[model samples]
Target: MNRTLTERARSMRIHSGLPKQFWAEAVNTTSYLINRGPSVPLKHRIPEEVWIGKEVNLSWLKVFGCIAYVHIRVFKYKNGSNSVLVVKKDDYDKCNTEKPIMKMDDGDSVFKFDRSGPFFFISGNKDNSQKDQKLIVVVLAIRNHNKFPPVAVPPAPVGQTPASSPSPTKSSPSPAPATTPSPISHTTSATSLSPI
Candidate 1:
């Protein structure tokens, strides 16, 4: 049994193209597979099935060295009044009017973060009109451990009133409250958007 395990482990490691450092994992996987496979000495019965008196679940099994991805679901506030754009670091720094990585027309779209990186969000109108542009820059830094920095809201856009503008003498009608939607889930590849 020991010789069989050693040989199977070596074969598995070589087939998977894994480094020698993964010998322990290879050995473990070999032992698991051996237990789940039919044994000639046991009348072609599976060892684990005989021991547990039940069939083992193999639905979750995957290739030993295959690439994997993570699924992410992001919940964004519903704001139909303005258009939101997600741009790369260089584009945001230069304020270039080129095509953005993502554009939220209805403001309720989901953005998946499949890997560790930074995402820059700027809210404004769809058109390039200066008057309709209300730049609200927000930076969301996602790391390997899922740590996120405090959301930083940049200063107001040029030629715009500062946040400390005085209140109007006459009362104005309050805008409609924004609604929150249910969480949406998706799976996507990692993007190259990261902080400078």
Candidate 2:
């Protein structure tokens, strides 16, 4: 067991390109995987499942050493406006805040990151008059496309027909029914940062 753990940890560290300082973390992660993985002695049952008497959930597993972004949000008490931005990898590493990617004062909460790369965020508000403000920055390292597989969308049901509308009479024409757009689905990623 010791030899197997050491070998798996070494492989994980080398494959992830992590430094030797993370040896303890690699060993811990390897142990976690081994516990959740199927064991030959247990007849292909996961060790954790056998011990806990329940099925193990593997949906949250992710590859190590993936690119991640940091989320920074600031709340202004005087104007009741909120500023939010996602810090990319490069800017986050250099801790640069000279210029932000996007800045707005309309209190927009929408944040979108389509591509995987380094990004940084800074407050658009230059007004330093408001000393009564609260700032909360949570640095999160999420698995990017390079490190993890993309999620597959389920296929639509075959032979599905659109609902028929009532025939409009000549006397009074019925207006077209308003159609609502389908909700967008976002893939969940694993976070590498531990909570403070």
Candidate 3:
């Protein structure tokens, strides 16, 4: 997410011809700093110049890059501090611990999900028998929208339909050829017709 955001910021600055200090100030939120690249200026440098307007909006702000505590309902035995995993992807699924619909962690939450792909994570699975921590490593595929769309396919070439389909029946005939008379003959015919 930070990488993508940084790339976007770079492009935004380039297109706008704005200085890096402007972006640095606008994206100076503590959370934003944590998630963004090291090249971005420090929080002190971020100022009003980078903001869309005179002031930045904090109401819509969220924790930058954070280690989210995954809720494990299936296997509750395994638990540790180092269990923190960098979120590789986020899909708004009700089943995943970080599902938008589901509850949120008390503290900061950094969910990393590809802009266009399912979310997945690999960790130790919680074991039923063992006393050690058993973490579940699996990929939770969730649909962003409620509807499940069918796979799309490109159309075939023109004049050719499906294999089971029949060919075209008939088409209109070509137009007849036009006849152009010589200039001399046309003038002579006109002159003779007028006189006689």
Candidate 4:
């Protein structure tokens, strides 16, 4: 067992970018995997199963140092989507919504989950109609696109600049006043409105 654990640790170290400081974690993880992982000499039954005389759950098996994506049970896993809307389990089931839900942990003011995956949440979700909604906290993972969003950048104006950029021999002209587009309002149209 000691030899196997060191061997696994050595393999992980070769493949992982983890530094020597995390060797302890690697060894511990390797030991855990060895005790739970299947062995050939034991006829494919893991050490834990052989000791306990029962099949053990291997669902938690993971690489010592690797990236993993978390599967959210209630969330929509649609095309190239990068966000999850966390809702209550009951509400999600009741509504038969495709939105994601999380299991509420017991006996704690806060619960933390080890993160994986590629979708991040935008700030702020509030419902004026729901009183207890403020207590809901959500964590989201965002897929990293190598590109960064432009800072403090807005849409360019529809037309060319009012003044041409200054030349060495010419004086620069002041920029023209910018026009702000009016917000479009949606009201009941004559055709859509119906008598109560």
Candidate 5:
């Protein structure tokens, strides 16, 4: 049946009065097939195999372009907790926008937004000292919360001993070195305590 239909289609190529409606339908089908091919390839393409290591996880799944909230630093002047801000993806489209605020869901914290806003993108987690930089910048959604509190800087690395005032000399002698006691052997019988 398909071969017969193909022969008829070939014969119809030479025929001049093939219905105008049929010609229009054929063109429409060809155009539709061409336009649909790219999207079909996208849907049918095999996803790259992802082998997660023991340390990596793939549990959380959120829709792209969905709203999310991120926590920001506490306000400097106000003595209160920081707030959550709404972040969206569309805000990070511009190139010149630096210091964009981004909201991250690292599983430990859940940010709640009071109002909807664009994500303020932050720089990626790459070390800035390296010469070949292809760092991914992260955009953060910062709420109107207070600016982050100053982090307590760690103390300087230990080197010098702290100076102490010299104590008066004492005449007491030093004690002898202590000796370890030998392990004692126990009998097989269990002991019970009696209450009065």
Candidate 6:
């Protein structure tokens, strides 16, 4: 047990960089874990479980010394938490845009919008398919009122704008494939230019 405690402390010093103030905690936690293991002298019963006469649930155990990526700090927009996904116009056409705000059922992102305007248009998750699919941007959703939702950004590598097929009525500079500008977020769910 002395050897084990010394080895654990050395390992923690080598990698964990935990302060010496927590050496007692390290020794205690290690002792508790060791006590939970099946002991040959105790007829293979875990020392900690022998008192309770129940099987110890080891599921809560984690790597003793490990590095975990809990979160990546960056620009808020780039973090992808509340990201505005920008996809190519060609890719945008594939969306079932009639309703884009999807409901997450059991962690599966399911399309649920009938008309439009539900609360959130969060990032897409895998439906039943095993393949990963690109998430649709929220800007394309048809708003319930006359006002437009957020702007649609084109999914081009940074510093470039994706150029759409030119309308004959207007001539616009083509954004290079390598350089795509943020596409206009406005997409109308226009029925007709009819008088109310």
TM-score of 4: 0.34
Q: Which candidate would rank higher by lDDT, 1 or 3?
A: 1
Among the numbered candidates, top TM-score falls to: 2
Weakest 10 consecutive residues of candidate 1 by summed lDDT: 187-196
Residue-by-residue lDDT tens digits, candidate 2, 38-99: 88999988999989898888998877655455443343333345453344445444444444
Clashes of each: 0, 4, 12, 7, 16, 10
**Could you tell me how far off, in angstroms, the CA of residue 132 lies in candidate 1 after the best superposition?**
58
Report the lDDT tens digits of candidate 3 across residue range 112-132. 343322234323222311333
| TM-score to true structure, per model | 0.36, 0.38, 0.15, 0.34, 0.18, 0.30
Clashes of 2: 4
RMSD of each: 29.4, 20.2, 24.9, 23.3, 32.9, 28.3
Considering lDDT, which of the candidate structures 3 and 4 is the better prediction for this target?
4
Output candidate 4 Cα RMSD: 23.3
Query: What is candidate 5's local distance difference test score?
Result: 0.33
Best by lDDT: 1
Of the two candidates 2 and 4, the one with more favorable lDDT, higher being better, is: 2
Candidate 5 residue-wise lDDT, 53-170, digit = tens:
2232234633222335554433122122222222234423332223435433332333333443323332232232122222232322322233335445566569966569967788
Root-mean-square deviation of candidate 2: 20.2
The model with the greater TM-score, 1 or 5, is 1
Predictions ranked by TM-score, top down? 2, 1, 4, 6, 5, 3
Clashing pairs in 6: 86-155, 151-185, 152-185, 160-179, 160-180, 160-181, 161-179, 161-180, 161-181, 162-180
